[model samples]
Target: MANYHRNNVENVVLGRHHHHSHRSKSASVAGHTFRLWNAASFRRIIFDAVSCGASSRYAARSNISDEKQHLQQKQQHHKTTSMKNNAKSEKLSDLLSIAEAETDVETKKKEEKLEDLKRLVKELQQHEEDSTKNKKSEAAAKVRLLAKEELEVRGTLAMLGAIPPLVAMLDETEQNDVNSLVSSLYALLNLGIGNDANKAAIVKVGSVEKMLKLIESPDGLDSSVSEAIVANFLGLSALDSNKPIIGSSASIYFLVRTLQSLDDESSPQAKQDALRALYNLSIFPGNVAFILETDLVVFLVNSIGDMEVTERTLATLSNIVSTREGRKAISAVPDSIPILVDVLNWTDSPECQEKASYILMVMAHKSYGDKQAMIEAGIASSLLELSLLGSTLAQKRASRILEILRVDKGKQVSGSYGLGAAVSAPICGSLSGKPDGGGGRECFEEDEEMMSEEKKAVKQLVQQSLQNNMRKIVKRANLPHDIVPSDHFKSLTLSSTSKSLPF
Candidate 1:
């Protein structure tokens, strides 16, 4: 039993050992499986962990890649923004340049406007200065003119005193100083000192010729210079009639030509002086026929119409009709009697009235027709009225005409009245009854018949006389008389009438 039990125990021990080995192997395999499984699980867990870790790592790597890509995208976006910012800065710079150019153009326009204003102001200032200068020049010219006038007056006074030095100074003076010189010469001529000897001295010095030449000079010699020259020449002409200094033919021609030349429209004073010179020349019997043959009578008649010198003209006409030659010269005119009668009736001035009356008296003494014409012209009645209504000079002239007419009437009883018989009968009345009647009574009846035959003859004669008188008055007053003076008269005997000449 012990043995068996031992055996069993061994067998059990072996079986147990076998089993334990199997169990150990199984446990080992299981442990291996468990280990494998654990390992696998661990490996799975590890792998999962690893895979998770790897995935996490990969995720991390992916995240890192995404972050890097995002970072790259952000970098690209930042670059684009920087580029846009740069472009905006460039556009602002261009706009600033345009504004600067516009400002520059505006500044230039303002500057130009300022310059234009300055120029206008300067021109205005210049114009004002020029106006002031012109006014000053005008004032200076007036002052100079006054000074020249005063100097002439003083020089004239000195020359009249017979100051030799003053005369010499005038001779040596420049032509521009002729105003004073001419004034002095005029005064010396008026003084009438040192008669023939002084005149001879002046002629020797060529003063007469110089004075003549001065008429055409531009120095504005006075009208008196012409008068002085005329007097000097006339005196010289009279003094040496046999030995002419300025040649007799030349002198006469020059005088006549000068008289005509003085009739220029610009020279009133020259015309007056020329007329005076002609009057002096006419007084010379030697020149009377020559003057009458020329245009001297017409010129004188025209001068009678001059307003500036009618008084001198009337005196000249009166002087012309007084002498025998003068009467003949006057009769040569176509209508002299009517003209003179007209003058007598028209004027109110005492001097003019006297002159007209004087002419009428002379005409009445000339011929039977002249007396008859005067009577028919109402000149006889006009004379009577004038005698009643005139001054002493006019009344005396009218009385003379009446006496001449009375003489003419008395002469008509004897025969055809001669001028001498007509003049003598009224003064003495002795010739009135004288038996010297030739054709005078017949001529008287014929004159009466002729006077009655013409229609309104007496009225016409009176009307013409009054009209002519009005014209004479107008001429004397320097006015125009276009209307007939007789148009206002109503009477037959005392009224203005037209006269017809029997001759």
Candidate 2:
């Protein structure tokens, strides 16, 4: 037991010695590192001292070992390299940090801009709904400005569910209230200017009738408002489905009255707008007879010299004279045939040329073929050009008319058959009794007698005034009034009720 106790004491002594030795070794390495750094400074001092005595061999004989000096220089170089590497890493870290910070700032700025756009759109929509008049007007002006940038916004309001409410907003305003009314029109115009779906949506909400009613309001409503309504109507009616709806008899009649109310001599813009609306409405063939009942046919035909009005005028007439009664009514206007032929030279539009050519073709088939007035108005040459280069339909009509006009009169007298000759037969039979040697006026007077009392007075007055105008227009064209304007000048025929023309 005593030997074992002695053995444990000896082991403990040995362990302590081992730990002390290891601690001493670590301390020695640290001391050596510090001393090496100091030795570099001392070597410089000692070299200076030796240089003062000029003793190179004495400096080499100093106490420091060569291996220890080499070790000290190695350690110093390693420490300097490590510090330079750390400094370079710190600079790179700073640059990376700056770049990351700049990227974060740009991302936040973009997010803020997007948020501002959303807020602006939402605010404008809210302003549109405000109860206060000023707020509503402000919203309207704002939204109008926004919609003006439709390419930028692309119906952003549509994304925010603002279109239908805007359509309904038109219902809340009075046509007489200029601010409220104009605002609604502006919004609707912008809204309708969106994609086809947006326009179809506007139409789906029954805007055609609303716009027409605003248009039909008396001249007392602000002209700007009326003009806006007409402009909006034009855009909406551009859709084919909207055309039939707005082209109803009542609306066409209203449009014609609107035209009559505008003085072509003074209010040219008003006349242009109203006439264009009527022109668009005339696309529906079913509405032609209703338009005929109004004095609009004579009105439009008379106004054809206005370049602003001529294209639409000829276009509407092209649709009108497509009907049998329409051709006869249009034939009654002294300026109609001549004006249609003149459109070919003055207008650059091929459609205008085609329409005018087609009208001449129809008139030739009905009455104008045999008339020296149509031939004098330069119908022959226009028909020739269109016969060759016009649309296929216009080409066919022009070819037939040329045959009628170019063919021998002896064949016509003998009832020789052609499309124009066939069409002229029915109208010629009706015109044979007129004062123009057509023998048709006595029949017109008889038909006039059969009309209602109110109709008789209006018809006589309109007839007398128109006859005077016809005489002047015919004289200006240097043609006999009796030849160009057919004798049953101011009357509607009750017998010809067919929608399609006799042709």
TM-score of each: 0.41, 0.52
| C-alpha-based local distance difference test score of model 2 | 0.62
lDDT of 1 by residue, 152-269 (tens): 3233322233333223423444556445455445433432233444444545555545555655567764554455455545545434432244432334444556667734432545
Superposed model 2: Cα runs more than 4 Å off: 1-131, 152-154, 174-176, 213-219, 263-267, 338-353, 366-400, 406-503
Every candidate's lDDT: 0.52, 0.62
lDDT of 1 at 65: 93
In model 1, what is the error at residue 150, expressed in angstroms? 13
Clashing residue pairs for model 2: 431-438, 432-438, 432-439, 433-438, 433-439, 433-440, 434-438, 434-439, 434-440, 434-441
Model 2 lDDT tens row, 362-476: 6776673434456656454555455544667667776776565543453321111221222221232355543565357655565445433334333343344345545655766
Looking at model 2, residue 11 earns an lDDT score of: 59
List candidate 1 stretches off by more than 4 Å: 1-266, 284-287, 302-307, 413-503
Candidate 1: C-alpha lDDT: 0.52
